[model samples]
Target: MSDGLEFLTVEPASDPVARREIVDLLASCGLDYEKQIEFFVTARQEGRLVACAGFEKGIIKDVAICQTLRGSAISLRLVSEVTYLAHSQGYQILFVYTEPHNADFFLGCGFYPLVEVPGQTALLENTPVGIKNYCASLAHYKVEADKIGCVVANANPFTLGHLYLITEAAKSCDWLHLFIVKEDASLFSYHDRFMLAKEMTKDIPNLTLHGGSKYMVSRATFPAYFFKDKGMVGQCRTAVDLLLFRKYIAPALGVTHRFVGTEPFCDTTRKYNNDMKFWLQEPSSIAHSIEVVELERTKRSGIAVSASEVRRLLAGGNFEKIKEFVPKPTFDLIMNKYATSV
Candidate 1:
């Protein structure tokens, strides 16, 4: 086995750093946490309390919950424990909003992705970090006609990488649509994801973020079995979903340029990305797909960081892998959740 980092759990809403970390992680993942869950902590593994994983009490309502720190195997073990605990306590299932990269990982954890819903992306509370109030007052309003860039992220936890994407997208566009997917409706609700996306991207100039209420952010947009059906393999040619989105959602929001990731680890994304290129390349007024590369990872695994890979490591019970992908504050929050589960 790999050398693992110790785990730690914090009291709910305590430890300012830990709480903030959770906020950041969810924001990175695009799940609004402020109004979604009743927080709890799990076991402590290291001298430093890392919030590995946490759970929502009782049965889930149309929302998903965080299960563990990204890329931590111990966290996966902890999530399993929480599953048993929640089940014994009369809980039906432990939910998580995740990217297609980790679909196999979750299946290994015994989580069967729902075919109908895929996973829901939630809107966060009190406006996401960097969004403007221009779009907030209007409920489900479309963006300006003069759109430039777009950030299409699962925003699984709304991290700095997300912020950077928005920051970069806005630099080139007059209007940036930070489309936070209500992806993989798991424990974290769609509202939370949107809200978190808004919060994190709020500061970016010309950046107007919105939630995917129609489920564009979700795997449901493409097909069932997100992980298995991720990027390259799924129904090729026209995503149909993206085309439908271009027909319906874009005009409403006035999205001109659609920004996406250049990360290749996610096979499903690779597939969808091809469709995005094909569609965007057309005579549409929208700019070509803006492909943003990963910020850094110059040292260790030359492979770019990804939510799917992160989930895989976490579900596999690995910790060291997370350190490379997530921030310290974020890592701490996940560890705290792990402690609570144990």
Candidate 2:
């Protein structure tokens, strides 16, 4: 509705300069613009980038506007355009992460704030299924009080390290709720990863598996969390995710303990684990405690066994090397279903 405002969808490949301008604008606003830059909407005033919003799948991120245009309708128009684009692409549920000061603008744009990390970040969603509703559905699967443990994993291809973590966590808790990352944003399909996890862990009697809904480290969280980007962007994303879990998911399931494997490699994951330890500690953040278990080392190479390593082996046609890291079920699936041609 703002006069002299022009809205354009800037593709990173086609309009690299415009994309760089948008990224610079977002970076000036303390937002990360490194990831999910493939498709974005920008508002220009007389050819100057004034406002912008980026989307990846159902997520709306890297939203920014020039300080002078704060009170104008530019933000609303940006949100509307991005939301419409997401809906047109078949995304029924959309999420946006914004700074606390800018919460009201998005709230007016029909997004409800789910959780906020004080001065850091706020998670909001524009959908019929709010956080409360989604958490409530999970409540139905709640176990006995103070006896449950949880593990949120992507299982890009469920590795033996994952199996070891789950098995060890199950040994200490009465019930283990394994939430497989349901976001299909990785090399392996969510279905394949989920099924592989189920098949491998089926023998563990006390382990219960659930899909890591959007509330968990899915599209709702910044994609940077999965990547190598470290610093405030990664920290904020990790904090918001763990905050959501500690506030909504943990309490609902009576989860007294959350378990994660120690990251010897990925700095992003290691920082995430460190943040989890700080955020979930008693009398400060949440009631649940965190356990950082040691990662399983490969039998042959003595390095940490990880999905990334498995993928590397697969890519290099070193299928035999992957058997040391991934579970038998995962190896079978990759060899038979996915890597048959290779």
Candidate 3:
């Protein structure tokens, strides 16, 4: 163990050289490091980046250590510091995705394992907010015999297509929980997107809106889900995320059905839908079986209505075209707030 190391925060934008070094270090460790990280803590030995860990939301990712420092206390200290920072920032829990071999290190550091996929990856968390606590938090909504359904969406700006999906799903269930992605990585802020979703769905009597927990398919749990280029990593992350949902969120909410809009484009989303179907059907994956509902297309010009399309039209100064894809509420919001920027 090295005694001369100092721990400090690394701001990627202000220090480009340190950012490059951290990226290189993570890549050399065979971990995906291209995703945006909000907070990073590093252990420097004489001003050299020896070990580092990143926190995005509540997830600890892109953890890397110099080979010479692997067996020492450096990695443990890095995790401890990052977890402390996360706690101070009001995160009640912290999740980490690490390779299977590194599971023991985190387990020893008080991170209980949630899901381990042999040689692939292990999902672990450190805090009292484990699966049970997460499930317990939502227990008030669970009804004994209600046919509860769920739809998790980013809703960058809620669109007519999203409304159509929710409408269709709501018709089939006694109750529906709509989780707007709380991750603020999209073009529209999470606050705006969530507000749009709530405003659009307010009239639906059976619908209840909830902010997506960090445990959902946010950048924290599935960073690659947002990256179009990293298909393999996206699939792996999606599987882990869905597994967590099946094990924790679904049963807690009494969700017997999961609804999603059909993905006509976006191969990544298509794969996610397929994986949802696969994992939800596995007997051991959940307490009770969940029916994965893929609703049909809501389209114009034979193209599906999507937030990305809305963004494209807004960028092109085609407000009229954007109006055709989005609901009235969303269209009004874009015109009022984003038209001049476009």
Listed per model in order, the count of residue pairs whose N, CA or C atoms clash below 3 Å is: 93, 0, 0
What is the alpha-carbon lDDT of model 2 when measured against the actual structure?
0.80
Q: What overall lDDT goes with each candidate model?
A: 0.50, 0.80, 0.82
Model 1 per-residue lDDT tens digits across residues 34-60 = 433344444443433344355544312
Model 3 scores worst on lDDT over the 10 consecutive residues at 228-237
What is the lDDT, from 0 to 100, of the residue 180 in candidate 1? 67
- Ordered list by lDDT, greatest first: 3, 2, 1
lDDT of 3 by residue, 27-102 (tens): 8887666456777898899878888898877778788898888888787789889988888899868888888888
Per-candidate TM vs. native? 0.49, 0.84, 0.86
Off by over 4 Å in 3: 1-5, 12-40, 44-50, 66-70, 87-92, 230-234
RMSD of each: 18.1, 3.2, 3.0
Residue ranges of candidate 1 with Cα displaced over 4 Å? 1-147, 183-196, 225-238, 284-301, 327-329, 338-342
Candidate 3 RMSD to the real structure: 3.0
Greater-TM-score candidate between 2 and 3: 3
In TM-score terms, which candidate is top?
3
